[model samples]
Target: MYLLGLGLVLLLMKYLEVDPVATWSWWVVLAPFAAAAAWWAWADATGYTKRRAMEKMELKKKQRIDKQRESLGLKPGKRR
Candidate 1:
């Protein structure tokens, strides 16, 4: 994510003709994009992406359930 943001910022700076970035070679300025791509590829291959998505979904489900229980005046259950 950081690499992706950096890549985008560098791209914008170059396009805007900002000094330092504008003077940098295209390869240097765009390296972060390649890095970001490689990092994402590695995360996907290792199931890190799936794990994170599942965790997020689980959290959302828990939140929804809690809201329902609260509306129904039910006691809280065990925390994970």
Candidate 2:
């Protein structure tokens, strides 16, 4: 995946006739790296393991709904 991205970037630079390293104005080259870093940081901070975050979120949502149902005096097992 890393090699693919690097190859695509190099292809794009070559096709665009842009000197990625020489052109100081090439902030585009940094965009993908910056985005990946930010995404990783956010996932790390949120305790979001890729395999478990979705399941955890779903569990929290169900618990919230159950709490709300109890507050409304609805039977817990009664599915709407």
RMSD of 2: 8.2
For candidate 2, the 10 contiguous residues with the lowest summed lDDT are 20-29
Q: What digit string (tens of lDDT, one per residue) describes model 1 on residues 20-53?
A: 8999999999999999999999999999999999
Per residue, candidate 2 scores C-alpha lDDT tens digits across 1-80 of 36447646855775687765436344555566666677778878877766587898888998998899899999765865
List CA RMSD, all candidates.
2.4, 8.2
Best by TM-score: 1
| Candidate no. 1 TM-score | 0.83
- CA lDDT of 34 in candidate 1? 99
Once model 1 is optimally superposed onto the true structure by TM-score, how far is the C-alpha of residue 16 displaced, in angstroms?
2.9
TM-score of each: 0.83, 0.38
Model 1 poorest 10 in a row by lDDT: 71-80
Q: Can you give the lDDT of residue 23 in candidate 2?
A: 60
Q: Return the number of clashes found in candidate 1.
A: 0
Show where candidate 1 strays beyond 4 Å.
Answer: 78-80
Clashing pairs in 1: none
Count clashes in each candidate, considering only residues at least 3 apart in sequence or on different chains: 0, 0
